[model samples]
Structure formats: C-alpha cells, structure tokens
Target: MGKLLSVNLAVPEPNPAKSVGRTGINKRPVDGPVPVRAPGPKHGGLGSGLVGDQIFDVQSHGGDDQAVYAYAREDYDWWQAELGRELPGGLFGENITTVGVDVNGAAIGERWRIGPDVVLQATFGRIPCATFQYKMAEPHWVKRFTQAARPGTYLRIVEPGEIRAGDEVTVVQQPKVRVTIAEGFRALMLEPALLPRLLEVEELPEEDLAEIRKRIARSTRQRD
Candidate 1:
C-alpha cells in the first residue's frame, strides 16, 4: 500500500517544442478531489482523464492508456540529489505524485485501488520527449533521464471516480508478467535486445505490441 502525496493538474504553458506552441507539462498540486475517467483514444479524445487537467499535444499525449501519470516521491528525492535542485512533486508532468509506491517497479497490468473508488491499471512507462527536455532547460536531459531509467508509469482508469491528496493506494491485483515499468522503458528506449521480453506482457497496448513484433522481425532478418 502507498499514499497519494498530491493530485496535480496541468498549468498550460507556451512551448516551441510542440507544434501547438503550447504544452500542459507544467503541473501543480491542486486542492480537493478531482474526477478521473477514461479519455477514450488519443488524438480526438478528451485529452486528460482528470477534469481540470489538459493535454495540448493530443497526437502524442493523453488517451485511455495514458489517462493518468504517476511518479514516486522517492524518485524525486533521488533526482533532487543528483541535479542539486528543488524538484517539485508535479514537475515531471505527472498527474499524481505518490509516496511509498514503486511506480517504476510496477508490473504491466497491475491494478491499484485508489482511495475508495478509483481503480487504475499500469499500462506503460513514459518516454521522454523534446517537450520534457525543453521544460527542464538542461542540456542532454532526455539522454540523462533515459539513462536513469526511472521513467515512472502511465495508467488507464479502470474504475472511474474522484481522487484527492493523501488518498491511500492499494494494489488489488498484480499480473504474473515479469516485465516492469523500468524494464519496459529500458527495453523500448535504451536496449533493443530486451524488446522480446516485452511480448510476455499481453496488457501492453496493441500499437506497442505491434511495434515490438515489427522490431523483432527486423532484428531476425538482419541476423540471418
């Protein structure tokens, strides 16, 4: 069991990294409970699972699979020590900032019951983008973040409801899959050799599975 430290919402900001010239990466902790529900698919969907939150880049961000983003406070502490700066709770664009939760270690398809009603299932790990780098304003931030391999987890709303700060998070179900968020991130971004391992987790989005299969096929042909 873990605790929800804060429920953050996007504070839209202008950015050149995105085609829209704006981004919702600037997230801040909000007071009171926020409604959460599935935002359907990407692109023409609702954008964000949280009511007040926004996602400017619909093509690349937000959807049913990535309805909610969560990062562990422990990881923030680590980054703060490494960067020697104050890393806030929602600085990583996560909707939820959690304490005592192994967000990176969570297995794909793992379901968590949050507070009293909301149920969220881990889908994938966040991949760093130019928008994130621009927000950080640090040279090689994408590379550094990728190398660190603590990319946090993106979850889909299983049972929609309201969530607020200080809510309790309980892992109600954990799949038998061995692939974890950290392993998935490393495989998809850093090392191609581990890509095959991701296939064992059926809960991954269809598009992602297709990409993994395509990459595996390409690698096999090259080997032959």
Candidate 2:
C-alpha cells in the first residue's frame, strides 16, 4: 500500500505576466483531512476546487477529468537532481503528494480507495500549460515537462470522503490491459505511434478517445 505524503492546498496570487492574473499553481502543504468530491462536468461550470485550495482558470482544470492531481515524491526527486534546486511537495501544482506509489504506472480508469470512503479514479495525465511554465520561471519548462513524460495523474472522485496526510492508499481496481497514465500522456500528447495502443483502453479521456477515432478513420480512408 502506498502512503499519502502530504495534502497541499493552492494559494491564488497575482502575476501580471501569466495567462491569468491570479494563479493557484503554488500549492503549500496543509494538515488535517480535506473533503474530496466531484466538481461536476466542465459544461456545467460547477466545482468547489479543493476544500481550501483554489484555481485561477477553471476552463482547463477543476472538472471531472482533472479533479484531483497527484504526483509521486520519487518524480520530485528526479527533478530536484536535474534542476539542482529544492522542490517540496506540491511544487508541481499537485494536490496530493504520494510516497511508494507509481502515479505514472496507474492505469486509466483505475480506482484507488483513499482513507475509508474516499475513492478516486485515474482519468488522465496533466498537460503542462503556459500558466505552469510562467509559475516555474523556466521558459523551456513546458517542452522539458512534455519531453520528460512523467506527467502526474489527474483523478476523478469516485466516492466522496475525507483524505489526510499519512492515509493508506490502495488500488481497488485496475483495467486488464496496460493503459497506464504515462502511456496515455505519450499517446495523447506526444507520439502518434502510440495512438493505436490508447484505443485498447475503454475508459480513457474523452478528448483522446475522439482524437484516436479520427486518426483511425483517416488511416482507414488512406488504406482504401
């Protein structure tokens, strides 16, 4: 069983250069259990963000597919070594920092039972944006992050409940075929060769689902 290292809350601040004047990508560690629930669909435009956390732009975030973001401490260590800087938990804008859990290895549609009642399903991988690039103060960060391909897992709340630091997280369910979060990122965002592999997973993100279908259709036409 993997452990929840820390529960981080975002603090929105002003930055004139960013896509949004207010930014919530700077997350800080917090104590105690925080409420976890679905924020509804993007079309509905309804969500509470995190309990004490916040988001500047809801259009690209805060929906069902990207409800809860999680990252492994091991990945943080990798960045720390590469960048030669201090990276605390939540530095990457992830709400939950995990230890001993392979966040990238988690399959799409996999369910994790957090605490007692809180359950979260892996939906997609985080795609870094210009807001994130500005936050990091690294101009090449978006390219670097995308090339690294260890994008954190974005989760949807399966069963609403409370989650706190030191809680045990166990994989309650995983898909049969290996459509891991990492593979999903590579296929959907970077490499077209991986497109066919992504189709094997049924519960993948809707955006990727539609794109793959289009790609298949285009290929079939060429074959004809």
Candidate 3:
C-alpha cells in the first residue's frame, strides 16, 4: 500500500486548439501544469487532456506524471531526459502522487481503492509520439522515458467518488493476472492484440465495460 500524498487538479493552464492524439499536445515543464479535458468514453475516457474520471487511462493521461507513470522518486532521471532540463519539482501534472508502489507491477485491469471516494483501475499504458519528443526537445526522449521509467499507471473513477489530497491508497482488488501496465502499453503500441485480456478481468465496471470492449474489438480486427 502506497501513501497517497497529494491529489491535485486544475482546469489545464494553457489549452491547445487541437488534441494531441497519441502524443501529448502541451510540453509542460517536468513540474509545470498542463491542460486537461473531460473526454467521453470514446477516446478511452481518461486519455490525455482529460481530468477527473479520465486521468485513469495511462495512454490518455499526460504531463509530468506520465514521466514516472507511477509516482516514485526513482523515476527522476527518466523525466529529466524527457524535459532535457533539471526537474524543479519532483513530479508534475499528476493528480495523485504517492510513495511505495510498483505501479508497473499491477495488472492491466487491476482496481485500487484509494480512500473512500475514488476507485482507480490500471486500464492501459501510454505510447509516446512526436509530441512527446517535441515537448522534451529530444528526439530520443520517448525511448528513454519508456525504457527507464515505463511511465506510470492510469486510474479510472469506478464509483465516481470525491478524492482529495493526502488520501491513503489501499489495494482493494489486485488482479491475479500477470499482465502489467507496461505490458498493456506495449500491446497497444505494438500489436494491439492483448487488450481483450483486460475486458475479461471481470473487475471493470458496467459503465466502462462496453467502451473497453469496443476498443478491444477494434484492435483485434486491426491485428487480424
């Protein structure tokens, strides 16, 4: 169990005209704030540029938190390379910062009960794009970030409860599956053939089931 230190949220400081898609739009500082949106269930719900229930998608969440993927001090080096500069703050653009938890170890469809209000699910992994390279000003930033940090896991709002800073995140449901956030990310970025494993977890909520199922079907056809 990791101690949830802070849960920060803002309206996204400088909004972009268009969405970044796979890559992130704004290249915020390692500790700087970025924009967030409320994506419908269509675009993984919590993908980048989204907040609240949306921050839960690893592929969808953006900013510095993505640098660590999980809030850990060990991820400092990876984010520095991505920014091409020193990190002023330990973490940035992360709604929930915590200590002690191998975020990447959790299964893809794993669910975590943080406090009483929030339920976080390790849905998917993030795939870097040109936007990430551009933001870091390094052509090799994405590769470095992925190799070293593997980013972190995303959390969905299962029950839709209020989450505040300094909350204690407890593992209410840890999936038995061996699939991890990094594995899920690679599956999406490379083969797109493994997403079905998550849908079968049986821990996902009904509201999120159909949307995740739809993504899996699309990916399966692409691979086929």
Candidate 4:
C-alpha cells in the first residue's frame, strides 16, 4: 500500500522534438480531486484519462491500456541523485506521483484502488521516447533510462472515479502472473529472450502480444 503524492496535469508547451509542435509532457501538480476514466483508444480518442490532463502524441500514447501513468517518488529520488538535479512529479509526463509504491515491481493485471473509488490495473511500463529525451535535456537519456530499468507503470482505469493527492493506494487484486512491469519493459526493449514469458500475462495489450509473437517466430526461424 502506498499514497498518492500528487496529481499532475500536463501544461502544453512547444515541442520541437515532435512534428506536432506541441507536447503535454510539462506536467504540473494540481490541487484537488480529478476525474479519471478510460479515454477509449489511442488515435482519435480522448488523450488522457484524467480530466484537465493532455496527451499530444496520439499515435504512440494514450488509450485504454495507458489511460493513466504513475511514477514512484522513490524512483524520482534516485534520478535526482543520479542526475544531480531536481526532478519533480509529472516531469516524466506521469499523471500520478506515488510514494512508497513499487510501480515497476507491480505485476501485470494487478489492480490498485486509489482513494476510494478509482480502480486502476497495471498494464505495462512506459517506453522512453524522443519527447522524454527532449524534456530531460540529458545526454543519452533514452539509453540511460532504459538501462536503469525503473520505468514507471501505465495503468488502465478499471472503475472510473475521482482521485486526489493524499489518497491511499491499495492493491485490491494481484494477478498470478510472473511478468512484472519491469520485466515487461526489459522484454520489449532490452532483452528479446524474455518475450516468451510475457505470454503468461493475459492482460497485455494486443499490439504488444502481437509483437511478442512475431519476435518469437522470428527467433524460432533463425534457430532452425
């Protein structure tokens, strides 16, 4: 069990890294309960699960599977020390900042009950992108982040409701799957050998599953 440290919403700004020319990665903390729900699919759907938040990159971000993004305060502390700078909540474009939570260690399909009503299920870890590198303004940030393997988890809204800062996060249900958010990220981005283990977690998005299957098939063909 952990506590919600803050509810951050994107403050759109010019994005030279993306062709869209604008990005919602500059998120700032807001003071109140925010409504949350599934934003449908990625492309042509509501971008963010939290009302007042924004997601400019529709093609690669935002959807039912990634409705809300959460990062742990512990991880932020580590990054701050590593980078020798201040790293705030939502700086990584996460909607929720959590304290005392192992976001990466959470199993896929694990359900978290935030505050009183909002139920969110862990889906996958966020993959670093160009926008993140631009936002961080760090050298080889993408590679550094990927190698650290503390990528935060993205969750789907299972039961829509309001969430606010200071809310307690309770793990209502944890699936019997071996694939955790960290393992999923490593499998998808770092180690292809781990892809076969992802199949045991049935809650993975279809696109991810398809990629896993394709990679497995390719590996098999090469072995033959």
Best by lDDT: 1
Tens digit of per-residue lDDT, candidate 3, span 1-224: 77655444433322232253322232222232223333335333344322432232244444322322334434544567756678432233445556666666677667777666556666555456544455456657667666653656655545445544455677777776667776666554544566676566554434445656777877678889
> Taking the tens digit of each residue's C-alpha lDDT, what string does model 1 give over 30-79?
99999999999997899899999999988889999999999999999999
TM-scores of the candidates are: 0.98, 0.91, 0.59, 0.97
Model 4 pairs in collision:
none
Each candidate's root-mean-square deviation in Å?
0.9, 2.1, 7.1, 0.9
Candidate 4 deviant stretches above 4 angstroms: none
* Total clashes for model 3: 12
| Candidate 2 per-residue lDDT over residues 95-202, each given as its tens digit | 999998999999999999988888898988999988878878875999999999999999988789889999999999988777889988887678767778888887
TM-score of 3: 0.59
The models' CA-based lDDT, in order, is: 0.94, 0.85, 0.51, 0.93
- State the TM-score for model 1: 0.98
RMSD to native, candidate 4: 0.9
Worst 10 residues of 3 by lDDT: 21-30
Q: lDDT score, residue 116, model 1?
A: 99
